[model samples]
Structures are given as structure tokens and as C-alpha cells.
Target: MNDHDRTASEVAHSLSRRQALKVAGGSALAFAAGRVVPSGADAQTPPSQPADPMQIILPETGITLPTDEVTFRWVDSGDSKALFFRAYFDAFTQAHPNIKFDYLGLPWTEIAQVVPLGVRNGNAPDVFQVPQEIPIAEAVREGWVRPIDDLIPNFPAWQAGFPPVSFVEGVNVFNGRVYTFPRSTSRRAGIVNYFNRAYLEEAGYNPAETPLTWDTLRDAARKVTENGQGQYYGIILVGKQVGRWEQYVRNMGRLAGSSAGPDDIDYRTGEYVYTSDGYLAAIELLLALRDDGVVFPGSMSLNDPQARAQMPQGVAGMIFEGEFTLPIWVRDNPDFEFGVSPIPTPSASFTPMGYQNTGTNHQWLYAESKLPEVAAEIFTYLGSEAGQLAFVSITGGSDPSVFDSVNQRAPVDERMRTVYGIYEKYMRLCPDVRIKNPETSQVYLRLQRPTPSFGEIVQGIYTGQLEDPKQAMQDLQDRQDQALDEAIEAARRDGANVSRDDYVFPNWDPTTDYLESDYAELG
Candidate 1:
């Protein structure tokens, strides 16, 4: 059967021998050897008339663009980089005119609520960015999402461009089946400092030359705030989004020598690092800054968009965000001179920030979509060499591609280039317990999140709702430790082949990429 003719069930169904053969005999050629879009158009495939989008041929891909009338929807907590996705959806429609490519951008808070509701009502987008509030494993086990390994032609070729651990069993994969490909990478988000060049300079600091450390960040913010005299502030943040608190702490905490950094798991011991010394220090610094009254007075109520807009109007000196901040500033506040740097550390000396090797493992496809083929096609195309390259070129590295080849060739400004350098120099791939034991996915499904989660703890402490930061973190940590132990046991009882030992990695190194070969050494 032609791809456009399959039902959603058939589209997501496991690849049978016959289906495998069909995929092999069909469009495998498009993705191989880094050639998704044909550079040279063949004269034999003449152009179709433009009046009808269905009849239009994509000269670049050498594929006749047409399909049965279908509405393909995608949603995300959209960002500046979403421009690239919006454009791709339009082009995708041109390639398959029958596809009414509908894109929806919502705040992640709404998305967290919206996705599960949509899935329950059978009205979710064909593809939606994972809210992270709902565990992916639970979603997969409940039949809300299916494996993507069978969807693409020559899956291996498509997966190769991504770095090691891009897909992990307990993470983006479950039971040997991959669920999603990271359309973006972590380097693009929540690990960089966006500073107003003038404010930093007036405060007698060069952010680019002297990256903010815990103490220095405090001093700088205080000095800038004093200069503002209540008119503007030292920094603005999306205090309404609790996640930003944890992210900023993690970024700086990692830079200050936290073993876990952003991963939250210290690979060396395979344990949580919520109360790591660096993490505690980062919290103290933030608390001191807040006590200094350097934080914007209205920051607590503002969302990211509001803070981002306010920053250019001189409301604050800095924001710790991803690379995506640069482009929006360029577009909306072009005259606002600014600079970027790695997130501040607790101390002056640098410590490598660790990340799970998985790319931006945020988006996922809904299981019961009416246009699964079209959804799959969009994912396949984006991961393609052509798609990745176009993404960078169009977005100008607003949200970087996981593929380095594309980012290396991207046309972006100085700030993006500077931060990409920071990402390369400091980013290390941490160990994935999933590669050693896939059964941990069950543990995740069963694992209860500790009361007053990391974000909540940070918020509570920052806002004075929590009296003692260390005690609060330790309490949460203990709860998490106990919760994890209980979850592992429960999963084991449920016949999952997981053990508490599965989470331990005695030989793992914090400074290097934990590849399969590293895991093999254990065996």
C-alpha cells in the first residue's frame, strides 16, 4: 500500500517483514550518504502545474508532492526557533499538498495540561512536544505513543547523524523501540547568559571576557541594580515558570563543579546531585542576590516573553537562557547591544557541564494521529541532512540542530558562535542507565516525584516560603532517594528486569562522553 493510504494503526504498527521490504525498496535512497534533497533536478521529472499544491513537485527532493487530503498538526511550547518549523510545515504542505500542515504554539504550562487532555479526547496534534510533566515511558506503555523505528526508511542512516546516546532505552526509547528524534539539542537552551552589554560595561565588567561566577554574578547584579536606582533592575527572570530556577541553578552549579550539572545524575556514582556542594553553593548565591534586591521587583509575576521584552528596555542586566534568546533579541530589540556567555559558576575556575547525549529529546508523536505518515515524514525530513542544514540556515542557530555538520555551516551572528564554542568546550555526554538496563523505564513509570520537587524547592527558597535551602534540598533528596528505591523494587516485582544496581555506574567518568564502548568495558 502507498504510505498516504495507511490508517493510523497501520502507520504506527510494528514493521512486519513485508513492511520492512517495502521501506527498503522505497525511499531509502533519499536519506543515505547525506543526500535527502536532490541537488540536481532530473529533466525526466518535469515540473507540475502550480495552481494546485497537490500537483506541485519539489524540485529539490525530486519527489512528486501529493497525498490524500489530510490535516497534520504539531504543537510545542513554541520559541523563536519555531519560525523554522513553521516554514518547514509550509514547504512540507507544498511537497504534499493534501496535507493541511497546522502548527500550534502554546506555553508549556498550557501544553502540559493540553496534551494529556487531547490524548484522552483523541484530539491531540499529530505531533506534539513532550510536556515532560507526563513521563514518556508511561505514555508509551499506555499505548498513547508508538515506536518510530519502523516509520523511517533506513532508520540506521537517519540515526547516524546524531551523536552517541542520542536515543536511550529508558529515555527516548522503550523496549528496543525508539519513540522520538530530538529536533533540537540541549545546547540551545537554559545554559547561557544573556547580558546587556552597556549594563555590564557600566558595572565595570566584561561578561564575555570574565564570565560571571557565583560571587561575581552577585556583585555585578548588585552594582547594576544600585546604578538603576529602582528605575531598572540588575536581572529579570520568568519567576512564574518554576523550571527556570532549577535550570539556572543547574547550569551555574555544573560550571561550579557539580558532578551532575544539568543531568541531575552524577555518572560517577549514579546518584542524584540535588544537594551536591556546587548545587548548594549556587542556591546560596542566588539567595544572596535576591536578598540584595537586585532581582526585578515584577520578575516574580512575568513570563519569559515578558521578561525577554523587558530586558531590552533596560529592566535588567542579564538572563540565563539558551541560544534561542539571541535571535529574538536581534529581531525585536535590534538596537539593544548584548553579549552571551556560559552560565555563571559558583567559583571562578570552570567545571565541565554534563548533558545526556540525547539531542533535544523534547518532542514526541501522538499514537492515534490521523496523519501518522505525514507526521513521520516531517520528522524524517527534519533529521535529514537537507532538513538539518535548512533549519540552521533559516533560524540562524536560534535553536541549533543536533547534527554538528549543520551547525558548523550555519550562518549566525557572533553571540551564537560564541555560545556554540562554550557548548563544545564544556558539554560532556553523561552515562545513560537505560543503555545498561531498559527495564528502568518501568521504574520511571512507577517512580513518585518527591514532594516540593527541585523547581519547587528553588522557588520556595528564593521566595522565602522555604526557610532553610539546604534542609529543604536534603529533605527532597532523601524523599527522591527513597522514592527511587521503592520504584525500582516495585518495577522488579512487576517483572521488569531492573535492579537498584542498574542505576549505579562505578566506572563512569564525568569528563567524557559515555559511549557504548565505555559501557562494554563493564561487561
Candidate 2:
């Protein structure tokens, strides 16, 4: 049904409930009072309740403002494992005596469907958390939210804290303006290859010092497989979606060539190097592994969480994962000896491009809100060192450097340090073009389809769905062109000034390397 119709129906339901309650209790109340209460007057007036005070607190900085009371409506994603939202509310309320938080938690699955409805209904929260990947530009283009740049000055620093080539760009910016702040980040890297030292020794190989190349990895997999027989597999690949395939593709790229600099941009030319030969070579390598029987059965359907749980159980020796899996690793396999290293390249000549998988800052204000200044104040507080630290501490993540001093004693992890190193050295701040306008963002998503008919030609060769790679590639290119044309046309119809030149495809070639040799060199 249309939005208006749905809204009318909901209103009718609410009115019906109110009418039923009155009918059930009014007669008894009138008899007890010994008088007949006027129907219209009683119906028009409802008992008033005292307003709750707004409470605000900065957890990391230990700043408390309990006197300022405000009720915050938030989506309650049903995942019990995700305590970030609830923890944030509790921490804020406990610290601020004047500020009281009214939380409205909705199921995770309903979040996307409900958020827009909230905004339209004037029931939107002062602060809301969203996944880094949700399209924010669409919200802005429709005037569903306001630009937050004027409200938060430290936004640039928050944006710079992430690895530039990562998905942060897709999360924060919309139509040249920032809209949402990131809370976490993720990276797609090759499997964390672990070998059974005993098995490797029996196979006449030194597991600790083995070269971390695709060929060496495969060789080790073969040896490990001999020991497994029918009980265990030599390797496990969580190949459930394009996300899994991305890690394999990245690893293969390292073998084929080096990555283009993360800071490098050619928005006007749409000349991303990710489409280069190196990237294709990487895809080919992954396909080769799939064909070699090194990967476990049912790999294409297995997700990352299942793969992670299986590792400590000894179901597989290697698994590809992001940094968030560290906590689980420590919990399930405390005594399990493992080593952490950057994913390896094909050769010494190649430099692997790592993915930065974390959240970012790109909050926005509501231009049409009745409490614009108050909303701005809330957003400003969020960007403040005190505000950001509180968010980080509660969520078990790091805050932006601009807010670092707020939580001086917070524990640091090796993975975070490594991520920071990458951010400082090779990463660049991602442009906010995608979210600059809803139409453009929609076009970009359409262009990123993972099927051959939709411009993802490499899918055919990797999945063995096509015999002729060259023909498939050509077909994919044709599909991409058609999609781009359609996108451009749609944008024009929506009055958006988009063109082929506006797109920024990633470049994954070695010839353009310009990042400093090491993270230390970045300074």
C-alpha cells in the first residue's frame, strides 16, 4: 500500500484502541463519581504527565550532564550480541542527572523500514546509529535529514581516521555533505592461514616460516589435507556472498600486481584502477584455488561467523576474517596458538591493498526540525572528544583522534594499532560524493551489481558459470555501459547533474603506488 494509506490505517488502529479503552472503563468511573461525564469534553482531554528531564553524559571523558533531560528514540536491533545501543543509553543516562533518555528499540530487521517512517512522522530520535553501508545520500536528497557540517567542526578529523579506500566513503557522505557518524569499520582480506605445526613438520615443512603466497598456501593446504582424510578439511572458505569473494579477490591482486594509492582520486575521469589487470589476475587466482580442491565443501554457502566458530573447533586450519573476530578468538581458543600478519602478496614486487573495515563520523542535523539549535547541540556533543569517547568506550571500539584524549586510559588492541598504522601510511580520506545526492548514490549501487548481466563480468569465470572468459568479460562491460546509461538517464529525470565523468572506480594497479613505504614514514 502507499505510504499515505498505510499511515491512515495506522492512525485508525490507534484511534480504535483508544475508543475501546474509554468504552470499557468510562461507565464504571461515571457511576463511582455519581454524575455523567460529558462525552466530547472527556474525549478531548487526556490526563497530563510530567515531562522527563533530558540526561546527557560523555562516557570516555567522564563528563556528566544529568540535568539536561531529553528522550531519545532508537531502533532496537534484536541481536542480543549487539549491546552497543543499549550500553550507550545506559551510560548516557547514568552520567547525566538532568538528562533522561527514552529509548524506543525496534527489531533489527525493521530498522531500515522504520527509520524513514520515524523521520516522516516527527518521531525521529536526536541521535541514531546506522550501518556504515546504508545509503545516506538518498535520505538527504529527499530532504529527510539535514547537513551536519555546520553543527560539528571536528568532523574532518573523524573522517580522516579511517582507511581511505575502505567502505567509509559509502557510509558517511551524501551530496557533498556529511549525514551520519560511523561507529565501526570492516576490512576484506585473505584468510588468516593457520597451519598445524605438527602436521607441517610431518610433511617436511616449517609452518612458522612458510612463505605467505598463494602457491605456498596451496602447497601447505595439500599437506594439511592428507592428515584430515575424512574428518577435517585442510581449509575453510566462507564464500557466502560477494563480501567473501572480495577477500579472495584482494589476495589474488597482491599476487598479480600492487594496489593503487588510496588517496588517489580521478572523479572527473572515472578512472579507478581496480578494473586493471592486477585485479582480474587476483580473481583468476581465487578461481584456481576453488578448482584445486583446497577449499572445503559447501564453502560457497558458508558465512563468516560459522567459519570463525569452526576454526577454534579445529574444523579448518585457515579462515578469512575481519578484526571484530578477535574477541571470539580469545574467548573460544584462549590456548590456541596463532599468529597475526598482513595478508601476503604474490611476490616481493607486489604490495597488497588492505581493506579498512570500521565505522566513521558523518552525522547530520535536521534543517526542518523545530529544535534545530538543540539538535545541533546534541550533534556537536557527539563530535566532541567527550561525546565520541563515550560512544567508543561503550561500543568497545576506538574514538576519532580528535576525541582521543577523552579516553586516555582506554585499552588498545593490536588490530586497532595495525589499522591505525594503515590509516596513517597508505590510506586517504574517502570523498563524500556518493552521498552527495540520493540519485547518484542509487546509481553507484546499481553499478556495483555482482552478476555478469549487471556488469560484474568476472563473476562468470570465478564461479565457472561461463567457459569463455574473454566473451564473458566483454558481455559484462556491455552490461555496465547499459547500466551506466540508465543511471545517467534516471538522474537527469530527477534533476540531478550526473554524468559518466562523475563516477570514481577504484584503481588496483602497481605502477601508481605513491604511499610511503611504511606507517612510520607517514608522519
**Which candidate wins on lDDT?**
1
The parts of candidate 2 lying over 4 Å away from their true place are 1-86, 93-171, 175-177, 182-211, 258-269, 272-275, 352-382, 386-410, 415-474, 485-523
What's the lDDT of the predicted structure labeled candidate 1? 0.69
Q: What is the C-alpha lDDT of each candidate?
A: 0.69, 0.45
| Minimal lDDT window, size 10, model 1 | 29-38
- For every candidate in turn, the CA RMSD to the true structure comes to 9.5, 14.3
Which RMSD does model 2 reach against the true structure? 14.3
TM-score each candidate.
Answer: 0.84, 0.59
Candidate 2 TM-score, true structure as reference:
0.59
lDDT of 1 by residue, 1-523 (tens): 3212332234223222221111211354211011112223334433321211111123342223335687777887665545455545544554456777666666556677888889899888888876655566668767787777887767887788677567877778776788887776765436588898899899998879987777788889999999988888788777877678878777777777777735487767767888988888888887887888999999888756666778888889988766766766765466889988877776577777777666673667888876666656667666765566666655557777777766777667777889888888777766677667777877887877666678878988988999998899889788888988999999989899887787777876767766778888888
Which ranges in model 1 have alpha carbons more than 4 Å from their true place? 1-68, 160-162, 186-189, 261-263, 515-517
lDDT of residue 360 for candidate 1:
75
Task: Give me the displacement of residue 372 in model 1, in angstroms.
Answer: 0.6
